[model samples]
Target: MIIWFTTLQIVVAVAAGAFCAIAGLAGRRPSDFSVGALALVEVLLIGQIVMAIVAPFAGNPPSGDPLEFWVYLVSAALLPIGGVIWALLERSRWSTVILGVIALAVAIMLWRMQVIWTVQVG
Candidate 1:
């Protein structure tokens, strides 16, 4: 994966996670803003998936297990939507916290995916 794009994904995941967490702490429900933030992350993640497809043909195949890479990619991409669905169903303050936690998980998973893709670190 491209380093800059991966970094951006991680940052966006973390930022969105933190935003939902703060809202949760404030006793607020899952507002549209937070959901929109999750949507933005979802879009970026989809872009990452598309880039993954394009990269191999462009001569940037995965250095690790491609199966694992793809699984992580797909799972991470779906997580936020799942979390939001759960939040809407639960309809509790803890649901906001759950969204925050789910967003954080997306961030963490993206970092792991980068590592599996053999991202070089500073």
Candidate 2:
């Protein structure tokens, strides 16, 4: 995992979490802005996938265990897509909660990916 991309994912996840928390606290449904943010996160994740694929050929393996790395990559990338689908189905505060959960999970996964990378490298 690229350091900068991982950092970016964490930041985006945190922001999404904050938005979800605030919406939940207000007893409001997810807004278009929240959906847009989630979409942006998905876009970034796709970019990360592309970078990961290219990194190996570029003479760098971001993660030593490509299988583990791809597992996290695929899972993390799917979260946002799943969130959007679920959110569309549930438009209330529940959707916001789902978004929050996804964001938090993705953040954790990113951290795990980094740890996996470090362990393999060391």
Measured against the true structure, the TM-scores of the candidates, in listed sequence, are 0.93, 0.89
Global lDDT of model 1: 0.88
Global Cα lDDT for candidate 2: 0.81
Error of 1 at 51 (Å): 0.4
lDDT of 1 by residue, 1-122 (tens): 99999999989989999989999888988778878888888999999999999999999888888888899999998898898788777777788888888889999998999898885332
Q: Candidate 2 on 1-122: residue-level lDDT in tens?
A: 57888899889988887787678667878788778778878888888888878877887665467788889989999988888888888888878878887887888888888777656663
Give me the displacement of residue 72 in model 1, in angstroms. 0.7
User: lDDT of each prediction vs. the true structure?
Assistant: 0.88, 0.81
Residue 30 in model 1: lDDT? 78
**64 Cα displacement, candidate 2 (Å):** 3.4
Mark the regions of model 2 whose C-alpha exceeds 4 Å error after superposition.
none
The per-prediction CA RMSD against the true structure, in angstroms, equals 2.6, 1.6
